[model samples]
Target: MADTILVLAWLVLAHLAADFILQSASIAAAKSGHGSRALAGLFAHGWIVAAVVVPVGFAFGERGWWFVLLTGLSHIAIDRAKVVLTRRAAAAALREAHDRHEAPRPPEHLGRAWTPQPAALFLADQGAHLAAASGGWAVLLAGVPLDPGWTAAIDGWLGSWDRVAVHGVASAAVVLIGLAIVNIRAASLFVGILVRPVEVTAGGEHRWGGRVAPAPDPDIRSSTSAAQAPVGRRWSIRLGPLDARVIAEPEPAIASPASPSTPPLGGSARVGSTIGVLERILIVVFVLTGTDVAIGFVVAAKTLARFRLLDDRDFAEYYLLGTLASVAIAIVSALIGRAALGALLA
Candidate 1:
């Protein structure tokens, strides 16, 4: 049973790494497009998945190759299904909006107070992939023994380390690595989808607190020439089931004086994402080591760094929603890791 669990963990870790870490942004975007580019992306992604899975399969023995074949094919099939479903849903949405005489919003920007269609689709896609992985494990690899040569090599490499201690360490490492990947890459994608930026017309009415509200900032119109100025924007921060707030967008690039020190938009987003990854990693470490209270310090320090920006209700709500989501995911991942570690070590 223990060996089965370890093998299952390796399979899951391989899947997560390939899907989120190894797959580049360009490849991910290309996969959603049409024709030859999409096929190329899918093939590239398949190779990546194979790269991660093949080594693990070989480590377990020849029979494990069957697991590799099952998992890899299922991944591609699931992804293709997701693409077809998303495109069909989008076309349907456009037709509905046309019939109602309403402007069609992109799927990513569909819902103001609820989960966006893109986010829901993303979750479903991932859920399907994971289910496939789990099902493959049960069918072909559930009772298979690890290769004797591989086990001997691991033991020899560890030298004088006690066997029980080595097993404990291996289990802990697997759990920690899996948790880190999910908390960092996967959570970033999820939160970004949920809190995507919204565009509105300058000085036009927009939804706020379940009602239409006029733009509050009178000086926004004079910030720049019409060509340079962006339309008004709002970020809907859903605080809870019954509570949501719309915050004004940050000053447009045209309004801010450009400096060599300023990062480009993409660079800025990358930096923010890096910070989020580090923050979640620290929280996971704190929770795993029985220093959960230290997680508070992590949150406090992050909030302090952006203290001045918090004065803007818009930025504050956006920041709060993101931070809360990050912290929640990290904490939950840590608790699960701790439980798995305890059970394995026992």
Candidate 2:
């Protein structure tokens, strides 16, 4: 029992530390606020690690908590290696510039400033998991346990065949850990939305970085922007791919009490409806299984809703909804498979 507690402690600490370090590295490399992207990337990478660890853990006896602890530490190490390599490459770019006597040009800004591709995020996530796993294995060697099951499992990894229990608590542990990482990434994205926007002056023009402040209550716009309407109204709702329009309405003496300052794209009620649909899909998938199509539907719906790509808040919300939606589809797919089997048996 004492050993079990130690192993659990190691898991939590390793997860927290790896998450922080990987995110920091991502921020440094991306040269922008992609914190949420980093979180999602880390979660995706952890799943890749689990692919190896799950089989290995099953081969080894499921008794010792050491296996999991080691995997977590190794994950940390892999991430660190990736980060180090990335920095070195970036530095080399600067070194070449310096050698030529030309000013070391800052890294060129890529296609989109705020947007990041999903695949990059996934790769970053894998790096993080690798680092953690590396670190974890080192720790495990220091206080190893004896178990006949584990010995057999390691042999299996060495190409020996073994009839280890493939579908059981051990498998569930891997799935649950993956789910937890996804959840953490989603939660982190949600929090990143709340960070304050920075003000900057460049090229003799002033602009807000990251996000624009919420527009004043529509009703108070008469007093606030008496001569001109608020600026964000241009992107309030896009009529087409490029065209935008301002939505005007009579200003009430007092705005609705429930409306938050940053009215979150849609009103509160619409947001709730979107959130409900996402949660339903997740619950269904968890109970069932393998519902990628349904999950894809949810992902598409949320992405479309992101038409209001006016600020970082909208971007974060879009990804959060997508994450939940994908999970739901997976659960639904699994449920479908089970039902098919039941019918065949009948």
Q: Per-prediction count of colliding residue pairs? A: 0, 52
Candidate 2: segments with Cα more than 4 A from true spot:
1-122, 131-174, 184-293, 300-346
RMSD of 1: 13.1
TM value for model 1: 0.67
Give the Å error, residue 153, model 2.
22
Per-residue accuracy of model 2 over 148-201 as CA lDDT, tens digit each = 665555557657433244323333443344344433443333222222111111
Note each model's CA RMSD in angstroms: 13.1, 16.5
Candidate 2, lDDT over the whole model: 0.38
lDDT of each: 0.65, 0.38
Candidate 1 weakest lDDT stretch, 10 residues: 207-216
lDDT of 1 by residue, 181-297 (tens): 898779887766554422222332222111111222323322212333445766666556766667676554421111223322245557667888999999999988999989989
Best by TM-score: 1
